[model samples]
Target: MLVGDGARLAEAAGDLQELGLGPMGTTQLAYLDPPYNRGGSFNGYDDNMPRHEWLAYIEERLVAARELLAETGTIWVHLDDAEAHRVRCLLDEVFGVEAFIADLTVESNPKGRQLDRFFAGSHDRLMVYARNPDKVVLDGGIAAAVNPADFPHVDSDGVNFRLLPLRNTNKRFNPMTTPTMTYPLYGDPETGAVAVDPGPGKVEILPVFGDLTPAVWRWSRDRAVERVDELVCRTVRGRSGTRIDIYQRDRHEVGRIKKLKTIWLSQEVGSTDTARAELRAAGVDGFRTPKPEALMRRIIELSTVPDDLVVDLFAGSGTTAVAARDLGRRWVVVERNPDTVRDVILPRLGLTGS
Candidate 1:
């Protein structure tokens, strides 16, 4: 649940823990995108803290965040270049090196700027850590090609070019992650084509699609068979050669193609424009420097899944709450100022405390 408090974070942590959050019962993710100690005024909330002060502030809040996180949950702290390293040192002490997932540099501004002192500071850092290193889920995979040319040979009516499987010749044991990813290799003596068991006993010739990493076959047996059938349906023998229908890669399915990266771009995540649009739709708008709904949405997507409870202490314009609701996740935003929560924030969300 979201709660805004005027007191120190340590105090709030105790209060939240007693409210039944710990271990396996409730999956709690304590996400704090606090002021970057950049001396910016967040609606009169002074964020400019001295170096030592920033470190101390992080220590207190990090302690509280750790206490509030569920055993299997995680904590994602966002910061700028100014104090990312300092914050990492404190995080390393608290969350440990093994738990550290990434030190992402997010591009805050895409358009390059004219500067003489240094390169345009287009990025920020997001320190991600799992409460329990053993169970944290990570999304990883290559970016899918959107153009049909990327796939090349269309196999079916809507299918893109299919990759012929390469025989698994060199197999290595990776104990850290997927153990079942190991297999054997096979090849055709005459055609010089490699035979691979994409999954189970399914065998197919390796495509001449240039060099591919071992075990990176185009598709598994079931998938390949489906593709073959599809290809046949759309296949037409022309005077030149066999022709195949091509289809554009579906954008929505990109998330499922592979694992997700720690570094997210403004395009991948919701942008300030999208956030403003959502707020506009909800009839909530005010606080300057409000987090773009896209930014909050990306955070929510990672830490908390649908139906999970999310809490944001510095509720500000309530972008977190709005994004959480839109994603089907329940959220609570705490703002000590009653007017911000009651009049400005809650009204926009259509929620009331009475």
Candidate 2:
């Protein structure tokens, strides 16, 4: 639900609860891009509130948001640095620190002027928190990862050849367990210790190890015999003769991408500006900072599977809904500004109002 006015959060929350609608269940995402307390105008509502009252306001929303979440639902609240710390503390209290997934910092201004007194503040924060700690599914692409066919290898035809290492190299080779790996790898196993095949009819066993070498092979003799047909030897042409054939058990490229981080930059998520510009073009102007569509798409992509439901509590310009819809995830937007929701956003989204 995209709400322009912060004051009406209570009413929206009440309506959702009465409807027996949860965030993931109803695609009921509550987006609260309220006034930054900078005296911004939200459909003629005052966004500026005293510090203590603001805290209460947030607490009320948190309580309501928690109730409105399905077993696996999430809520995203966007705010600037002005009150991010306070919001964090409040979120921690409501959702628990464990449920808090990300404290994302998105660039609000790319080419704006710098501040002389201090560093120029160009980014805003979006705090993502799950409703239930144990039940929350934080990963968005769970459905995509479930199907084995999605990781199909290209170019190779033999059962979709995936290049996997025969053994783990993170730790030192186990002297006892990996004794054979200690010695130089011999010829292809199909040809009985031959690394090179003289055409398809003959096998040549190259002396990769010296006579003095004494160690067990990486696999037992029987096991090696069983897997003799699984190896592929790759040979390249020209000056760069890259000769490397790979063996594999699976296609997953482990250790390629690092673990996720908290802060998110704009470049990491492309199309942020295009999304903001789309809102402006639709005449829903004056939204000083709106997250890029790609940025929001990344968040939804990580946390929700296709056909799953995603909720964005701070739905400025409906970026989350647009991204979710594009990614094949279901979404529900809650917004207070009739003009923005009924006029600009609905027409842009092609949703009919009742």
Candidate 3:
């Protein structure tokens, strides 16, 4: 379904309900790329607005959006540094703080924007929130191609592997919050055997290295015990005495799927220049900023399955619609600019009318 009136998203959603589309929890994913309120002018819409007015504008639509989302649905709001914090607060109010998800930082521009004052702006923020966090389904195991040369060590089975530190690197991992990850790991100095309990040949290992600070493990005791075969322990001679270091041997297998990270680099996701080029190739003009199809494809693949309903409220150049259709997903788009909807979106989608 394509809508030429973007301002009436709530009304459009109501119309869909009448057509037996979204009766109150039917949309699986809603991807919004609304205007950033940076005083920019597009073909038929003005992005400039006062702070309070903009917040009110977004809040009303968001209220309607919340009603259209399924119990396990997710919404991604794309914005810039201009109103991210304020928008986050609004989202919290609209969707409840418990439903809030990750604030993904997308590197839309690889080359930082040149400015005479202050630092350069290079990234845009994507706020991801779910209607019900416990029930939300996310296929985070989307892998990116890696070079074999990056992993140097060859295991006994002739598989290339890399040693990853067993200690938790994130500062947010506090023992107070997660007591299970604060336990000590006993290791044998001679042999590379590790044990959670003290034994005759095992020595108690300190979480930190000579530092009084508390150390935390990435995995809990039970998890570590379950994956003991993948663990590698080595005895290292230090100034204090002999200490055992724990490592996890990560094998480099072809076509391996890994969890997607919050930071999306421009090299992995297409940049602004790539988006412009794509629009030009599709004979689309007057749309100043368009998101690349690669970015939309990645978002769709990460959050949805084939035949899932995807909604794009700010359908600029119709990149999301095209990406969803190509990926075998159903999509509904709304564009405020009638010219863009008629000349660019419909033509690109091979449709004659809105």
Pick the TM-score winner: 3
Q: Write the per-residue lDDT of candidate 3 for residues 139-181, one digit (tens) a residue.
A: 7657664567778999888999998868776656757666678
Off by over 4 Å in 3: 1-4, 10-13, 18-23, 112-120, 139-141, 145-150, 156-158, 165-221, 239-241, 252-261
Off by over 4 Å in 2: 1-8, 11-14, 17-32, 42-45, 112-117, 140-261, 270-273, 281-284, 352-354
Clash-forming residue pairs, model 3 = none
lDDT digits (tens) for residues 149-262 of candidate 2: 544775444444355444334343454556545433344444323322244533332112122223334444456457756544332233434332324444444322234556
User: Candidate 1's residue-wise lDDT over 188-294, tens digit each?
Assistant: 33323333334343333322212332233334445533443222112225555543222112323333444566566767664444556666677766554456776
Candidate 1 or 3, higher lDDT? 3
- Give the alpha-carbon lDDT of every model: 0.58, 0.58, 0.80
Query: Estimated TM-score per prediction?
Result: 0.68, 0.63, 0.80
Model 1, residue 320: displacement in angstroms?
A: 1.4
- Report lDDT (Cα) of residue 349, candidate 2: 77
Clashes of each: 16, 24, 0
